[model samples]
Target: MWQQSQAGWQTDTGAGSVMQHRLRGLSGKLLWLTMAFVMLAEVLIFVPSVASMRLRWLEDRLNTAAAAGVVIDGLQPAELPRAVQDDTLMATGTKAIALRKDGTSRLLAADHMPPQVDAKYDLSDVPAFQSIGDALYTLLFGGDRMLRVYGPIGDSDMIIELVMEEKGLRQAMLAYAQSVFSVSLMISLITASLIYIAINRMMIRPMRRLTHSMQVFAENPEDPARILPPAPGNDEIALAGRHLALMQEQLQKTLKQQRNLADLGLAVSKINHDMRNILASAQLMSDRLVDVDDPMVKGFAPKLVRTIDRAVGYTSEVLAYGQASEAEPKRRRFRLAELCQEVRDILAIAPDSGIDFVDSVAADIEVDADSEQLFRVVHNICRNAVQALANHRLDDPGALRRITLSAQRIGSVVAIAIDDTGPGLAPKARENLFTAFRGSARSGGIGLGLAIARELVLAHGGTIALVEKPGPGTLFRIEIPDRPVALGDWRVRA
Candidate 1:
C-alpha cells in the first residue's frame, strides 16, 4: 500500500519538475488550460468583431454612392464628365455605382465595371449567421473576387447598387484581425497567469505538502515524530491532514504493540525452557505428596498437584502467545458445569476474601469444546474478577463482591457469562480490553489474560465480548458453537 502511495507521489513530483513533466503536472496543466479557455473566449468575440467591421465598411461605401447618385440624378439629361465620373467611382471604392427607382436602372458613375460580379449581396436584411460567414469568407478568400452590394437609401424608395473589388476590404479585415489577435493574446496571458497563481497557492502547493508528508511518514511509521501536524482550516486539505495524523497515530501504536509482542515472545522462549524444567521437577515432587497420610496434607496435595499442572500448561500457552500463534483446540464433548467447577477450584479464592463465586450452570448442560482451553478462558476471567473484588472489598467493606459464572445450551451453541459485582472495568481498559499490554489497568500487570482468553475462544470459532450490564462490575460473555455434524454421521444417527 505504501509503495503505491510513494509511486503516485513520485509521479506527481516528476510532473512538477521539467518541461516534459510540466504538462502532466497539476500546476502546469492548469496554467495551459486557463490560457486555452481564455483564448477560446477571445475567438468567440473575434468572430462578431470582424463581422461588424465588414458591415460598417460596406455601409460607408453604400452611403457615399447614394449621395453621389442623388446629386447626379437631379442633373437629368446633363451628363457628367468621364474624368469626374471616374473620380467619383474611385472615391466610393467601386467599379460602378447605379440608382434604381420604380424598376428603372440608371448608371450614375462607371470605371471599367466588371461584365458580371462574382457575388451579389442584398444587405438590407441579411441574417446574423450569413453575415458572419460572409465576413470570414472575405478574410480567407475574397482578395480576387468582385462583389455587388445593394441596399435601400435610408427609408427612401430608391436603392443604391455598387460593384467593388474585394481585395481592399480583405486587406483591412486582415489588419484588424492581426490587431485583435495581439490584444487577445496579451489578455489571455494576463488572465491565465492570474488564475495559475491563485490555483497554485490555494490547491497545488497544499497537495504537494500533503504528499511529501505522506512519503516521509511512510518511511518510518513507528516514529511518532514523523506524524503530520494537522493543518488549520475547514478545507479538504486540512481535513485530510487531520485524518492522516490520526491514521499515523493509530499505526504507530499498533507497530509499537507488535514490537513489544516480538520482544516478549523472544523473552518467553528463553524463560520457558528453564521454567518447564523447574515445573516438571515440582510436578514430580507433588505426585509423591499424594502418599502422605496426614489429613490436611492429603486434602491439599491434590489441589497443589492440580495447581502445578495448570501452571505448566499456562507456561506453554504464554510461550505460544508470544509467538502470535496457538494450538488449535482439541475439541471433545464434555459437561460445561464440570468445567466451571474446575475454574472455581483452580482460582481457590479464600473464603474470607469477601468474594463469592456463584456457579449458575445446570449440571446436565454439555458443550463441545477443548476442555483445557475452555478452562483457561473461564479461569482467566474468574481470576481477574477475584482480584478486582479482593481489592474493592478493602475500600468498601460492605460492598457486594461476587463473581457469577452462568452457562446454558442455546440450540447448537453454548453461551457462558461471567459477571462480577465489585467494580466495572476502567474506561481505558475497556477501550483496549482484549489488546495485550495496553488492556491492563492494574500497575505492573501486562494484560495478556483477556487477550489470550479471547484468542482461545476465537480458535473454537466462537465469540467473546465484554457486555454492558446494569449495576457494578464487568460482564463477559463467551459463545462457542458446535462444529458442523457430518452428513454421514447425521444419517447414521437418524
Candidate 2:
C-alpha cells in the first residue's frame, strides 16, 4: 500500500499508477488518512494493553503458586503426596514452586525442574516502557525457554518464586494479541467510515458542486442561466459562491451592452455611405447659397453651410466608433481665446434663448495643441453644456442661464475651465462620466459627446475631468501639456 522514499514511506502518487491516482483525489485521501490515524491510536493503546496482559498473567500464576506453596511448606516434604504435588504444579502451570522467607529459600513443590532458567522477572517495580518493550520482544522473538518469576506474596514478607515454561506464556500472549488486532481493525474501519461520511457530506460534496458550477459557467459565461445562484450561509464556500454569482451577473450585463453596441455599429455602417453622399450634396447646395446677395439669405447661408459640414463630421465620428482608436494629436501653437470664441460662434446661442456664452479667456494666452482636435474637445463639452442648460428648469426665475469658458497658462500646460449655470449632473452620469452611452448628464442623451471629448484631450497628452463644487451647476477642467522639445531644437530656438 506504501512505497519507500527518501522522505520515508509514501503512498504512490504517480499519474500512471492507478492506486496513486485514486489516492490523489481528496475523497480517497481523506478516507485513508482517517483510517491511518484511527489505527495509529489503536496501536498506541494495544502496546500498553499487551504489556498489562502479560503482567496480569504472571501475577495470577504467582498468586496460585503462593497459596499452594504455603500449604506445601507447612507439611514435611515426604508427607506431601507425589500425585497431589503434581496436580498443584499442573494447576499453577509451573514445574517448580518455592517460597523465600527470612533469606531462606524453601522448595515447596518440584516435578522434573529444568537445570537452568533462561530469563527472570521481578514484577514488583518494572518501568512501563521496559515492560512494554519486553512484551513486544517476547511476542516477536521469544523461544521455548524456562522463566524464573518471583515476587512478594500480597501483604507478606514471604516471596513466591515459580519456574515456568516461556512457551506457554508466549502462546497465551499471541492469542490475546490476535483478539486485540481483530477488534482494533473493526473499530478503526467503523470509526474511519463514520468520519469520512461526515466530512464528505459537510465539505467535499459542497466543494464538488462549486467546481461543477464554475465549469458550467466558464463554458458559457454570457448565458444568464449559467450564473451561479447565491448559496445560503456565511461560510467561505457560501461567500465564494455569492461573489461568483455577482461576477457572473455583471459579466452578463456587460456582454449584453457590448452586443447592443456591436449591432448599432453594424447598422450605422450600412447607412454610412448613403448618408455621406446626401450630406455632400447638401454641402454643395449650401456652398452655392453663399453667392446670394439678399441680406436675409446671405446671413443664414454661412451658418447653414457650417451646420451641414458639422453634420457630415458627426456622421463620420459615429461610423468610426469602436473601429480604431483616435489618431495622435498634431500639435501646434494657437491662441486659446480664438479657440474658445470659435466654439461660441459654432453654438450660436440665439439672443432670445435664455442662455449666455461667456468667453473669459484673454487673447494673449496661447496653447500648444492640435487646433482641430482641441476645437472638437472644447466644442463637444460646450455643446453638451448648452443642451443641459436648455433642458434644466431653474427654481428661481432670476437665476442666470450662463455657460462660461476660461483659460490660464501654468508652466508648459494650459488649463481651460468650462462652467455652466445648470442643474448639476445626475448621480448615474457622474458615476460613468467619461463612459460612452452611459455618461449622459441629461435625459435622451447618448453621452458620446464627453466620451469623444475625453478621447481627443487624452490624445493631446492632457487630462479632462468634471470638477466638483458646492453649487447648482456643472464644472469641467481641461489641461493640455505642451509637446516636449528636443534638446538640439531647444538650444537652436534659444
Candidate 3:
C-alpha cells in the first residue's frame, strides 16, 4: 500500500546552512533562487524515477502472462491451455480474463493476482484481439499495485490477467533520493560555515584592528601604539600596514620640526625688540651724517644713511614676524607706478652689478593698500629677485641680470608681475613655497622673504603667487583690488 502525506512536499521553514551562508555573504535573492532550483531538480528526478517504476511493473506483467500461456481478449485475462499453464503462471505471477465479443470480464482464478490489487487495476472495457487463432487480448493499466495486464483465452473463452506491484521500486527510489538530498544539504551547510569563519577572521578582524589604531592615534599622535600587526608574508595588506606606519613616523617628525620653529620664534622675539632699539639709535646718528661737508663724506654718507634706514626697517619686520601677530593695514589709495619706481631706485643694481630693474606700470594705475605694508611686500619680492640675479651673474658674468616689474589693470583688480633672470625654483622648493619655512631654497637664508611677502599681500585682501616660465628664472605676481583715488589723497606723510 502507498501512503500519501503532504509533509513529504513541505518547504523548509527554518533557515538552514545554505540560507545562513547566503545571509552572511551572498545576496538574499540569488540564494533563494538557487534553493528553488535545487528543489525543482529534486522533483524532476523523483517524478521520473516514480514513472519508470510504474512502467517496469507493466512490462513485467506482460512478460509474465506470455510465459504463463494466458490469452488476452481486449481488457480481460483468461486461463491458458493446460500444456503451457504451469510455465505461464510462473512467468506472469497474476492474471485476469474477459469475454471477446461483448468485452466483459470474469475471474477465472483469483489466486493468480498480486495481493492488495484493487478495482483501480480493472480493465474490462478495453478492446480485444486475436493472436494465432486463439482470440487473445491484453489490457494494461496502472494503480496502487502499479500495473495490470488482462486478456481472454481462446479454447474455453476464459479471461486472464497479470498484475505486478511498484511499491518496492518506489520505496527504493525514495530512499536514494532522500540520501542525495541529505548529502547536498550537508555540503552546503559545511561550505557556508567555513566561508563565514574565514572572512570574519582574515578580513573583518584586521579591519577592526586598523580602525582601533587610527582612533588611538587621532587622540594622541605621539603615543607609540600599534595599529597594524605585522603579517609574516608579503601581501597587499602587509604593504598597506607598513606604509601607514611610515606615514605616522613622518607626521611625528614634522610636528617636532614645527615645535622647534616655534621655540626659535620665541627667542628671536626678545632679540628683535632689543635690535629695534639699537637701529633707532643708528637712525638718529645717520641723520647727523647728512650734515657732513667733505666730498668723501658726502659721497658715502648718503649710502651709509640709506643702509641704516634699511636696517631699521628690517629690524621692525623681524620683530613683527617673531610676534606672530598682524597689525591692521592702514589702507589708503596710492599710485602703484610710483611705488614700483621707488623700489627700483632703492635696489640700485644698474651700473654696479650689471643688473637692470625695469618698470612697466601704467600712469593711471591706483590700488587700495597700506603704504608701508605694501612697500614691504614689494620690497621683499624685488630684493629676492635682485639677489637671485646677482647670484646667477656671479656664476656666469655674461648672463643677463634683468628684473622686470610690470603692473596692469585686470577687470576690477591690478596685477603686478616681477620677473627675474635667475635659476627657477627647484621642484622640492616649489611644492612647499607657501608653507612658512618648508618651501625655502636650500641656498637662501631661511626663505622668509617670499613667505613674508605672501603674508603681507594676503593681509591687504590681495594674492601673490609664483608663476613658472618656460625658460630660466622665476615670475612672482601680486594682485590687488583697484580703487579710484584723488591725486592729492594719494600723498604719503614724511
Best model per lDDT: 1
- Quote model 3's TM-score: 0.53
Q: Sorted on lDDT, highest at the top, how do the candidates line up? A: 1, 2, 3
lDDT of 1 by residue, 1-494 (tens): 99999999998877656656645799888988899999999999999999999999999999999999999999988999999998998899999999999999999888886877899988799889999999999998789999999999998899999999999899999999999999999999999989988988888888888888899989988888899888889998889889989999999988888888888888888998899999999999999999999999998898899889988987777666656578989999999998888788878788877788899999999899999889988988888888877666345567677889998888999999999986788898989889888898354579988898999999999999999998878899999999999999999999
Best by TM-score: 1
Q: Which model is ahead, 1 or 3, in terms of lDDT?
A: 1
Global lDDT scores for all candidate models = 0.89, 0.87, 0.64
lDDT for model 2 comes to 0.87
lDDT of 3 by residue, 276-329 (tens): 899899889888877888788887677678767877776666746645656778
Indicate the TM-score of model 1.
0.90
From the highest TM-score down, the ranking of the candidates is 1, 2, 3
Which parts of model 1 have CA positions greater than 4 angstroms off? 1-24, 290-303, 322-324, 393-396, 441-443, 491-494
How does each model score on TM-score? 0.90, 0.86, 0.53
Tens-digit lDDT string for candidate 2 (1-494): 23346334233344346556545779778988988898899899999999999999999999999888888777756557789989999999999998998899988889998999999999888899999998998888985788999999888899999999988889999999999989988998898889878987877777878888889988998888888878788988888888888888988888887888899888888798789999999999999999989999998898789778878987787665567787677888989898787788789899888899999999999999988788888988888889888888888888899999999999999999999988888899999999988887678987788888888888888899999888778999999999999999999999
